[model samples]
Target chain A: MKLFRMLRRHIRDAFKSVFRNFSLSVASITCITITLIIVGLSIIASLNLKNFTTEIEEDVTMIVFLDADTTEEQISTLTVEINSIPNVEEVKFKSKNTSKNEMMQESDFFKETMSTWGEGDNPLKDSFQVKVKDIEKIADTAEEIRDMDKVSVVNYGEEMVNNLISAFSMIQKVAIIMVVALIVVTIFLIINTIKLTIFSRKREISIMRLVGASNVSIKIPFLIEGLILGFIGSIIPIVVIIYGYTALYNHLGGVVYSNLITLIQPEPFVYIASLIILGIGMLVGMVGSAGAVRKYLKV
Target chain B: MDLIRINNVKKQYKNGVTAINNLNLSIKKGDFVFIIGGSGSGKSTLIKMLYREEKPTLGEIIVGGVNVAKLRNRKVYVLRRKLGIVFQDYRLLPKQNVYENVAFALEIIGAKKEEIRRKTLKAIEMVGLKSKIHNYPDQLSGGEQQRVAIARAIVNNPKLLICDEPTGNLDPERSKEIMDILEAINKEMGTTIIMATHDKDIVNRMKKRVVALKDGRLVKDVEKGGYCSEAI
Candidate 1:
């Protein structure tokens, strides 16, 4: 019962101080909200970037045109050999007839021009479409398969794939640096704001200390004040993240750049992002106030 | 047994300023003792040492059987819990009213709600500020504010009351009134009172036990002494 009463008093004092220094509280909340908004936007951008990169990686397929003089038995043996590669996930055979039929269905000119050509006269090459498990190892796997006999030429957009991988890696690095810098700045701002709040009431704290108030009693209220500030600060950013992300998703209609890039759906992504922002806000507030209060608690 | 025993206590500040040097003193329980010294004579340092605010550099200060110099940081608050210290500035929370100010002492120690209310009112009444219970510190006179401070200091009914120039800011009349409240608390409750002061008139008039200091050393101690030996 005594412990409960003490907790109640600490909470009461925390809230009282929060309003007692209203301007400082608002400034702290604003700092946290702005920092969290930046953090939230970065998270959303990074998540979508990760999704887009994965889609590009999955679409990377190596097409291996068979040698024109290779027999059907040799072609089948080559397909089995290609599937045996460690990094190769799937190998699908596309016969010349099947390729011609797909082209005729896809284009009106192919349909008009290919209707007079019989299967015996088809100019299309029989190829094997090879998908790799790891996009980073795709180049090595394609090289290995290209050296195999009966393989005429292999194309997996080698230069374009290399550029995309390097660009994505660079974006990841920049995003990480940005997130860390923002968090550090947020912590510094919170510490200064809380230091000011504690400075304003330093007299009261000294009096309490002289009266035999324990260190825990002196610090708990300030910790609670920080927590309340953090909680309030997170609310605005959470709302903004949800509303902004959903609106962006709707405005872009899921895909960008002729269906080449896609945004993550708002279902679990927004919820997770909101949770992360709230967590960061609370953590920064707690840590900042704790650091500020430690210096004045020498009594 | 002595309520407080200081054995060859030495206090040197970080800047090499010796606040108190080779000081030895003892006070019995329920004794109202005056610590009389001029400016920079270590009167404040002695009173602060009694409450464990500033530890002696070289000796042991045993208060109520506890060696304060050896007490750890976490246990310092426990020692302070048994001591009620009043300052010259009347360190009452400016925003808190008389009742709240007195009650704050009990609140910090986690006293029960009913116990806090009863004792707070009793302390306020003892200081003759029951009428000003709801008035804030800024709204009260200097004397009244000091009374509220006294009330807050004694709300927990500590075994020892240390006052460092409690009436330094008040006029002679107001200082006497505050002194009267301290005397009443000492006589009625047997709470040991160690007061540091520079007021010669009150020290001469009260005729209490007086300990005098000069150059951080105890120059004189007399039973029923005045502010100075010549005055006695």
Candidate 2:
């Protein structure tokens, strides 16, 4: 019961002090707010970038072109050989006629030119569309298929795809490192901000100690003040995340530049991201206050 | 009947200055004792040791039956709860009013709301600051601020009241007013009072038990005496 009363008083004192030292409190809150907003935006961008990369990775398919004179039996054997590879996920054969028809449908120019070619004089090659279960081993799988009989060429945009994947991975790594560094910087900034607040009230704290306040009792109010500041600081960032992300998603039509680079749907994604921002803000705020108070307690 | 017993206490600063060296003193309950000394004569160090503010370098200090010299820093607040301390600067929270300032002592120690109200008002009234209970420290005179400090000190009803030059900042008239409140608390509640001061006039006028220190040694102890300039 006595503990409950003390906690109540600590909370009251924290709120009173936050307002009593309004400028200092504002400085702390502003510091948290600005840092958390950057953090939130970075998280949103990194996750969306990851989503886009994964989508593109899944869409990658290797095309194996066969010789125009290859027999149906040889094609069947080649399909079997390709499917036996450990990385080969799926294989589908496309006849020359079907390929020609697809090209015709893609454009009026192809339709106009292709209609003049007789069936016997057609020059399109039959091919197998291949998908691999593991993107990392796609090169090995492509090599194995190329050595097969009657195979003329194998193409999956190897260099461009490899470069794209590696570049995306590097970007993701840099994004994560940037976010971590920002959080670390925020913690230090918040600690110094709260230290200033405590320094201003050194006289008040000395009086409290002389009056017999325990270390825990003396620290409780400052900790609560940090928590309150962090909570308030996170509010604007949360608002920005929930509304800003959805608006950006809507304005961009859920994709950036093309369908391969898509944004994450904002339904639960925004909510989850908002929660993360809130957690970071509160945790950093409390840690900063605790650090400042610990230093003062030592003195 | 001894409320505080210092057995050969010694305090040496980190700079190699021995503030109190092999000093012994004791005060009975309800006694008004004055510790008089020149600057740097170990009077402040001796009083600070009583509340566990400055741990003695060598010796035992027992206040209210607890040995404060060996008390841990984590448990210092426990020892302090049994004593009240007033400083030369009054040390009242500048933002708090007289009533809140007095109540703050009890509030921090987790006293109940009703009990805090009763005791805080009683302590404030005892210091004769009932009319200025709502006044802030800046709004009050130097004497009134010192009275509030006294009220805060005694609000917890500590067994010992320690004052380190409580009236050093006040004029003669205001110093007398502050002294009157301290005297009332000592007589009415039987709280042992230990005060360190440089004011020879107040020391001589009070005619209380005077303990004089010189160069970290207790030089003179009198039953009812005036301030002495040196060892006698």
Q: Write the residue-wise lDDT of candidate 1 on B1-232 in tens digits.
A: 8999999999999999999999889999999999988888898888888877788899989998889998877677888888888899999887678898889989988999999999999999999998888888999999999898888888888889999998899999999899999999999988999999988899889899999998798988999998774322
lDDT tens readout by residue for model 2, B42-140: 898888888877889998989988898778877888888998999898889887889989999899888899999999999999999899989989998
Report the C-alpha lDDT of model 1 over A6-26, residue by residue, as the tens digit. Answer: 999999988987887788899
Prediction 1 global C-alpha lDDT: 0.87
TM-score of each: 0.94, 0.92
Interface RMSD score of each model:
1.3, 1.4
TM-score for predicted model 2 compared with the true structure? 0.92
Interface RMSD of 2: 1.4
Model 2 pairs in collision = none
Candidate 2 local lDDT, residue A272: 98
**For candidate 1, the TM-score of chain A alone relative to the native chain A:** 0.91
Q: In candidate 1, how many Å is residue B137 off?
A: 2.6
Whose TM-score is greatest here? 1
Q: Is the docking of candidate 1 incorrect, acceptable, medium or high quality?
A: medium
